[model samples]
Target: MCCNENFEERNKGEKITTTLDLTEISGMNFFDPHVHMTSRTTDDYQAMADAGIVALIEPAFWLGQPRTGIDSFIDYYSSLIGWERFRSSQFGIKHYCTIGLNSREANNEKLAEQVMEILPSFIFKEGVVGIGEIGFDDQTAAEEKYYRLQLELAKEAGLPVQIHTPHRDKKKGTQRSMDIAIEHGLDPKMIIVDHNNEETVKEVLDRGFWAAFTIYPFTKMGNERMVEVVKQYGPERIMINSAADWGISDPLAIPKTAVLMKRSGISLADIELVTYRNAISAFAQSGQIDEHDFIKIKDIDQSQKFASNSILRGGQQPRIDKNSIIIS
Candidate 1:
């Protein structure tokens, strides 16, 4: 049973697939500070590495559906550090994670309490980078309580906080997310406020916090909009992410956005600051990242097979290089 059964299952059906052209965008390495790989497939990982995503961070977030027990949180956290990390390495991508009680799920007081008790155990573990993807989901009281608690945890551990502002009532939510972090004694520099739009970027930057924009499809800031953001606010402490998850999202959002910036006359220095340098600086707060680890992956054994694992089933072929010659 290979980890990826989706691609193999698809091959069994009589269907034709078209590959996206990524030839013009090769050789540039990226760090997608945010992604939910648990919701993506192995094929996505292989393509990401091929597209130059050398490392990524997976923050523990609420599932589309709520989790009911502490055991579920433990299992999820374990996978972020264990199976998920291992699987990423298999594709030559380094995986790191952040563990926390996401605001959306904090409404369940009982489970939240249990989750809080076990969080300390995971905080200092290997590959656990920050305390985050935590903050105002609905701006509710329960959300505030857990957000403060996690902020304290981050302060205690000296780890950075990755905040998720409310989708609705966004401006106020983004402001309040920063306010509450400050109220809890977290420095603005230690917080990475994610999913910022034009309405909220100025306030976030003025407050001295790191503003991270997600180049999502349709709904969130697209590359064009993000380029405008770079123009409005120079890329000092700004970063970009795909925040790509179970929804209709793109993992190549970071690089694609960088390309757009380049085409729009943004300098390579500015481009590097947002896409690579910013994320590296933010995650480096964990003191776990090594700058020397950015070298090209060598000797990737595409022909290698895993224990009871293969990228295919029923004698099908494995596409180690998905963007290339499929000599059929």
Candidate 2:
């Protein structure tokens, strides 16, 4: 029997289950390489912690619309370091962030320029592991300009970079993103060329850059395709992410994909490498990812306020166990 089936049978009794819930991954931990927890709810945080999400890396991304000012960028960066970090810790998850001028918003040359000046300040701050989710969106000149700038910031900080490849013209854009990072003298091993698919994975791996696949619901790669990439490429410098944000995304994408891979005959070591080990290795380059912080839950006071802002609509309890398996 496969690992998922074996674990499930041993834990849940010998019955074929059809759900894609967290019960399948009871004892395993996951590291979500990309997610926008700023837009997510406390319920999401509670669910993630319950699902064994020991750590996550949140990248500064473009909201559905463009941000207007530098103070907005400042506040956003502060939230990543301050509020978000505190919020995640309340549930026993280590929160890390990547600061950069994202590709879509890079089109606003004036605002992007101002944001660039402030990026260096935040990139080295605590909880920031890299300068990232920063690359081409439309493969435009402006996007390339800021992408190179952020690569320099990452290089200066001695940190790794998490690149966001263009959704359109992805192959050329992915290649160009890597080429520029190399041109800026950033080591290929220090860069993660994310959102890679079949067309781009070979070049990414061959160039010594890490290839990250986003296993989303309807766009980017799905779990089945991700499994194939791992099978063909053999999972050395490859990783998977949820990139779960303000859209239809799954925070459990990594663990769920790991479960699928196990059921499909991928080895446990291979599953662990892509879903967990690879991310920790890359993020550790920041010198801020503390293994001890992730090792144990800091004493969570269930009585304290959940977020500096409110986690409830009215005055709901902060400690709701969403995963209670009740069979009434």
C-alpha TM-scores of all predictions? 0.86, 0.86
TM-score of 1: 0.86
**TM accuracy, model 2:** 0.86
lDDT of 2 by residue, 1-328 (tens): 0012354455675666565576766898888989999989888887788777899999988877778988998998899999888888877788999988888889999998898888778877888889878888888889888887788778878999999987778898888888898899999888988999999999999999988989887668889989988998897999999898887688888888888998889998998899988988988878888777786544334334466755433233357544578633
Q: Evaluate residue 106 in candidate 2 and report its C-alpha lDDT on the 0 to 100 scale.
A: 93
Worst 10 residues of 1 by lDDT: 296-305
lDDT of 2 at 8: 48
lDDT of 1 by residue, 32-80 (tens): 9999999899888877877888889998997788998889999999999
Model 1 alpha-carbon miss at residue 210, Å? 0.4
The residue-level lDDT of candidate 2 at 226 comes to 91
Cα lDDT of candidate 1 equals: 0.84
Q: Name model 2 segments beyond 4 Å from true.
A: 1-20, 298-318, 321-328
Residue 266 in candidate 2, Cα distance off native in Å: 1.0
